[model samples]
Target: MEIGSFDAADASLKFGAAAEEAALNTNVVVVGSLERLRDAKDCHKLQRVLEASPDKMQLITSVARAMSAKKDGASARELYLLPEPVETDERSGSVRRVCLIALPSACSRHNSPARPHALTSCLKGNAGPGSLTVVAMLDDPSLAFATGCAIVRAFPTWVAQSSTAAKMQSKKINVIFDAPDNEAIPEAEIAVLSWAARAIRFTARLVDVPCNILNTTEFVNQARVVHALLQSTLQARGEEANAVSLEVITGEDLAAQGFGGLYGVGKAAAHPPALAILKYYPPGTSAADQATIMVGKGIVYDTGGLSLKGKTGMPGMKKDMGGAGGLLGTFRAAVGAGVPKKPLYCLLCLAENAIGPLATRPDDVHTFYSGLTVEINNTDAEGRLVLSDGLAFAA
Candidate 1:
């Protein structure tokens, strides 16, 4: 039970890598309480050991073959999980990089900078207290891929809102049902399945929309449609999406906000710059459980300010608003869900790069809304400039 005695020799391993590497076989088994693995030094040892293996397989099984014949001998299993850890790719044996967790459930990765299952953080247990199994595997790692992503259970078999507080039994499926203790909400599967299709479509469409059609103004406009759809679910999909609250702040309005980063980037364009903001507040729940702010980096056109990008350097700068599209799509989902308790905020900063005398110059000392004066090192770096002011205002 002493953490000091245990070395986290297997701390860096991921499930897939642990399974794939025939030579570097490993699995983590912790004896005794959670307290033992919680120590800082012991955790370090576990990390080093997990990193030692080289496999990319998700559900890895290995046997400690050296033991003699016995019933409980090597068959018994113990499990441990590190909330977060960093290590190189034990699967491909590529350059070591900082991965998210110690044991990943399902990972699809490549040598590229953005790899799969890499960003995923496994949920070691179930939705609530002790009921969630401290098992050997992860539940759909891809479901919670990014930092802000979360898992939620949507529909229930039947509604049970009423309850007589004093007449409760020690154990029973209450008249009002949440998840009964110790049972994994099978709904995460169905709910995520429904969400996945749309998430994939949104991800793919936004990916294809090309930065040209998905600028700050367009992005905000699209979000307005999403808001309208939320207000009334019966609203038809395509054209109805266009009939929402579309408020675009431009010209002097954008300038008055002192968002010089957005203004500077949009100044060269014949079309005035735009700052777009959209909001959605669902009925009921006065305070709301939580409010999330979705902000996208909107670079309408990146001609590279004064430091122009050549043909090859600028092939896909148009898609710079990928983050914005992601945010808008997420809003669409929140709207589609009839339960609108929490208020959601969507902000998109937009601008196009038009080459003219007014265009910002390289090494230009552009002032940001946050009042941080950045030396314009490169015109092509305009994305960060526009994002800076947006981020500052967001703060």
Candidate 2:
């Protein structure tokens, strides 16, 4: 699933502004609290419908009471559908039918970040692929952004692993944030929210692919794609052409340059290993005299090398490169969002540890890029070997 595929917008919309109308005309309209519905500016019209029957009135009251006592972040209450749409306002216009989902306190405890996994259960059947409106009653844009991230996180449908590779598919759910009409939503906040959502989704997809589909060569290509995206994004802003560059070193180049740790760990794999570097030079500087470096382990798949892994231990080896995936995602988003006026560097150490005649043995002692000799007591500890070279390069 591609994160950037979704659309999100925060606008000057009131709390529960369309709840009554949406309940009668749309599929779903989510709200954070019951007070939003009970104390809405147009609640009288909704009150009349909710009070039409004693049972319905009791249900509404019960929900309000339950939500009032809810302390944990974002717990779901009983679902309620209104019998009719609210009386039309010439200024407000027509409303669509929707199911109202009320979330209790979200991130109210010590400013803790909202976790999408915690709230996924509450959102399962109520919201679907199309359009989802997250009404932030508290007037916190970060809350709205958090809620949007959760929505995107829970909405994507995963498929079974396949022999033939293809890009991950997402439903492209549209999310809208309804803030208080008096409040104004900032464009920068929206951009950050969108970028965050996309970056997370991109990382998840990267870690999910199998080693064959995302090996050393393929992973370097992926890094290159992020590099191109950063360059293009910078160029589109009319930035200097030399601002961003991506450099890759692999195979003989790694060995010749004394990257023994990296070369030894990956020499046995079908695809040659590589070290990918993404460099961002701020405007007006042609040289990167001193730069901050971020290093990531890109072990595409770990088969325990000469040490060998049991069947149970080998299944999820594809996710071994998670550090690299996260680094690339962050690099792409940070550059797109505009980095600080300093040289920024991201280094990826890419490799795959497989069993073969050419693989390094447990007793092998190899000299690393740092001029340190490491005795390979066990080849299963290859991640450290690759990282040793990466750390040396960064130093």
Candidate 3:
């Protein structure tokens, strides 16, 4: 009946703060050729490990190789957490956990995909919930951004499982860029990454929530909540609240508008099928000329209708609305990034593809909103039906 209380603002604030603090306190260790490693500062722990292993290249290359020999057979990465915490600043007697990130010498020429794979693989397994991870800055901007995104993407696993746990678990991990003193990466850039991460997490959570809790009506209501948050943020900044608006069309309105595709697919459910549109029109922007429409499928729960799916397939039907979830997340992120000046529209075609006496069956032909007749050969293909209505309307 509800997706319950998931607050977006609270999540953004918490994640951003944690990431900033974590970046400041990171104990950085640089891995490269022996000449470079010896010249690198603040890598005392790494030096000790090299002393024991006696082979720097082997130590880096065999990070997962040696671990695979253990009984668990777990997938591992090149990042290793030193058993002994190293003194980050000897004068202040400050110490932090030293994590070694291996980068090849002359990394610019390196083109191995395993670099990011190793980074995310290790962090996903070892990093704690709501913890901050700091990696030494990569000279390549594209690589650094990709690594940051990977770090942010890993946080959602915990969020998806948090509801079923005994203690409310945190699924947010802040990944900060650990640049050298000479580097001047702005704080705003890091915050942008946090916003992007939260958006991704938000989308994943919406898709992961059970359909019973996120039915059509509830999904629309959730959109309203997000819109209201946007309105509030705009008002606080003395901007026009009407710049962003949400319009929801459902039930008789859908029928009156001749949305046969949406109606045919959703009429069987207790909650009526709906089309929710979130529109953003910045000042002085012509809605007709400067519009970009984003469409998402919002099948709250797909039971495959009369062409019912097997029990195994039904369990994962909750993710049928992933498109809508991702759209909404992207909407928020775009707004947060302050790039919504042009006219933008997000159309969510929402419905529950449930079975009932009213459900459209095989051999049924429905005239869609665009006046196109579609024969229902199999109700399992109903997602396309609803999406057709959305595309037609948006176009």
lDDT of each: 0.44, 0.66, 0.64
Q: Give the lDDT of residue 295 in candidate 3.
A: 90
TM-score of 3: 0.76
In angstroms, give how far residue 361 of model 3 lies from its true place: 0.6
Q: Write the per-residue lDDT of candidate 3 for residues 1-395, one digit (tens) a residue.
A: 34555563235323223554434232432322223233334333333322323344345444423332212111323343333334863233233333444433322235442255455555556553333434434443334445566555545532344454312333333344433333545556655665566677677768867876788988998899879977886677676888889999998789889999998899999999999999887667767775889999989888899999998888888899999989998887776655676888999999999999999999999999888998999999988999999999887
Indicate the residue-level lDDT of 386 in model 3.
91
**Candidate 2: where is the Cα deviation over 4 Å?**
1-74, 77-117, 120-126, 129-133, 136-139, 155-170, 179-182
**Steric collisions counted per model:** 21, 8, 0
How far off is residue 302 in model 3, in Å? 1.8
Give TM per candidate.
Answer: 0.48, 0.76, 0.76
Report the Cα lDDT for residue 32, model 3. Answer: 25
Model 2: ten consecutive residues of lowest lDDT: 5-14
2 or 3, greater by lDDT: 2
TM-score, candidate number 1: 0.48
Model 2, residue 24: distance off in Å is 15
Ranking by TM-score: 2, 3, 1
